[model samples]
Target: MEGTRYLDSEFRFNSGRLSLDLAATVRRRASTPIDVLGNPNACGRWLKAAGLFSDVPELSAENEEALIRLREAIWKLVTGAMETRYPEDATAVVNAAARFPLGTPQLQSRSGTVSVVSDDPFATAMSTIARDAIELVSGSLRLRLKTCDQPDCRMLFVDTSPSGQRRWCSMQRCGSRAKGHAFRQRHELSVRA
Candidate 1:
């Protein structure tokens, strides 16, 4: 699908968590935001690209709406956890999502070797993301949650660095741009001085 190309190039998964990655589907949260999931096929493409599905699942309109609701719930939960005030509704939404039956991994033996494959990949992927959100919010990983520092960027990411001093969603992208902007400002100030 044409939408698949957009997802491949634009979707950022540097968040270290699927829930956060889903939240990043919307760009520029503080300003004019662009909902990357606006396209009907975008969700299916996203699931495939995220390694959540071996084959793209057909998503009806209702399914798309449900997915969007889940994504928003994840965003709200993460925001609340970051602010140290977990919203009860957001927590409930995440818990309900986790209650969905995840795909059963079945062992496949072939040529004297064994491999595992999920029976219901879509459900498994969504449930896994929900569970990960639960862990991130209530587990020790909560302290590592961080939103990108770039004014125009509103992606959330986990600081997995050894020192945990990371401030950008991606150093090669937002970080470099921020650093370059600062350098230019300093240079302009020096010229005036």
Candidate 2:
């Protein structure tokens, strides 16, 4: 806490879905935003992590720009869906992206491993994410989408937990910190009393 600042070197995949994970690349959009997908390589890393491709796909600056544009549109659509207000532009972007062809999963008999390959990996990844978003919004899981309760987090997530009472994006970070803060405030109030 003294000197080491939090670096945005790695991609975050905690949102539980491809589109949501992509949406999480840029954090705190309302205030100071931290963009984890700062470049094509980062985007490729995230796609690889998402299991979109067996190997990391080559991405260009244009790909990065397109990805960022789609990510923002996805964020808008997701938040709008959460509020029961789907933006026209966002809807169009996601719908168009979803229409793109997805990667074909081939079962390699040599290794018996399924690898998703595509003539255009970028298009495949983008379409896959957009399709996931579409399904998430149109399906029953839309009711479970929730933003993190931590004031500074500004993260969106699905409340898949039993009882559907999940709040923080990460219990170890936001939930624990919030609980500790409340405990400290309560203890201080008791001391004052």
> Any idea what lDDT model 1 has?
0.84
RMSD (CA, angstroms), candidate 2: 3.8
Native RMSD of candidate 1 (Å): 2.5
Local distance difference test, each candidate: 0.84, 0.84
Collision pairs in model 1: none
Shift of residue 100 alpha carbon in model 1, Å: 1.3
Each prediction's TM-score versus the true structure: 0.90, 0.90
For model 1, the stretches where C-alpha displacement exceeds 4 angstroms are 1-7, 111-121
Which 10 successive residues of model 1 have the least lDDT summed?
A: 107-116
Model 2, span 63-158: residue lDDT tens? 888888899999999999998989999999899888888877889989998877788778878899999999999889999999989887878888
